[model samples]
Target: MTDQISDAQFTARTLSEALPYIQRYAGKTIVVKYGGHAMVDERLSAIFARDVVLLKTLGINVVIVHGGGPQIGKLLDRLGIVSEFKGGLRVTDEATMEVVEMVLSGPINKSIVRAINQAGGKAVGLSGSDGNLIQAEKAQKTERDPDSHIEQVLDLGFVGEPSAVDTSVLDALLKSNSQLIPVVAPVGVGKDGHRYNVNADTSAGALAAALGASRLFLLTDVAGVLDKNKNLMREIAVDAIPDLIADGTAAGGMIPKLETAAQSVKHGVGAAVILDGRAPHALLMELFTEHGAGTLIS
Candidate 1:
């Protein structure tokens, strides 16, 4: 009985500490890029859904943009479609694009929406092609030959980057009488009437910028950005991002994520955080505590 009473008191104290943060974020919008190991882990995904509901209950509007690279690859392999990657992005052909859309816009998007709904929150699933939410252009890349130092353009068929984002559908849903959390899949339609596979991090940054979100949270697999010694960097200024990339502190998938976070902050987001999504209730720890859970960029 005494231990129970102590636990109750602790809970009360924690709530009291969170009151100020709750007030600060009330009525503001936040964009979350959900992906990585968190999507595959059942227990963590449940915690994430409940945490999102708790944020909405506190009057903070939340938007989710999710990725499904592993799922897409798995389906493509099963169907005997050859997969290729150039510069860390999938070289999507017409056949690959179909599978990407089917996985991202169909099952994965609905699963996330269902999770949130089951957690007692209203969630609506959407694709970037729906309502023309994301306008995209074919992405291009160049690589320099080590021996000749000559740059050659590589063609990554249907992969695209956002040119513009139309938020009318999202705005209507958020402003409706029945509040609904929007879960977006990152398959965009190009101006040439082609379907393009968009990187989830880039899509989330664009949406956050268009919506003037207060915070952009990227749920990643790591413990946030690290320095040369592999120590966590708690806070990074937007200007320092370029140097981090040039100095080799950031590489691989982390490059695009850091770039997206920097761009989102520059475009009017209050801040952006990249933290470990595998950690249970990471969102709550970052938002409500004095010491945040990830590396913050502003």
Candidate 2:
């Protein structure tokens, strides 16, 4: 019938469209910063796992960095702990640090690892503390009084930034024929023997720089960067980010994402993308199709 014929034609076109992308990305390393809506939706979660497995099967190395903000918030609420944020950074005191570790490392990281395994890929769950992978220092807090002063030092109990990253451990994992996919949680320790919660995006950016990855993909809830007309802008130069931020088009969390993308490009990574994670097979569509779905910040 006519309906059956339409379905067949669509299937053929879809497969043809995907062929070039599979060929292009095969054998290259892709670092996927996996979070946002895709992680919360069960069907989307399975699809994401399948996409990673397929990439591995085709010989593309995948490194996954995940965020657990929602999960941490949920747990904090359950425990009757109130969270405070300064400049969008969670002010992590001692008690909050405990919950951060428990949620990020225990349930969330392991769940992703399990999904990848169930989807038939080899996955390893790692924290920044593992193999001394991420060495961090206590992030210096800023005091905003009448005069913004760095002299007023407030301790954001366990918020740390990556001062150093050793890629040797990651290299060894990738070299094995097992096609190991690393699922990393951003929790690092400082020289002063304190645990700190690093922003997952920052951690992933640093990892991409350290590993010199071919692509760094940040999966979020939006459909890439929009122009004044609200149309998705496919390609954007790194220098334009400042204007976008200043013009109020790129505000809120997108600012940090743009900052990370700029840092990645500056440090020798090929490209960084901010793609909508809600779209099914969004990863494959972005990587393989000529018209990608998210903002490609080069």
**What are the RMSDs of all candidates, in order?**
1.0, 2.2
- In the range 190-242, model 1's lDDT, one tens digit per residue, is 88778899999999999999999999999999999999999999999999999
Q: Per-model C-alpha lDDT, please?
A: 0.94, 0.89
Candidate 2 ranges with C-alpha deviation above 4 Å: 1-13, 141-143, 146-154
Model 1 scores a TM of 0.98
Q: Whose lDDT is greatest here?
A: 1
Stretches > 4 Å off in candidate 1 = none
Model 2 lDDT tens row, 183-295: 99998877766778999998999999888888999999999888888989898999999999999888888899999999998998889999999999998888878888799
What TM-score, computed on C-alpha atoms, does each candidate reach?
0.98, 0.92
Per-prediction tally of clashes: 0, 2
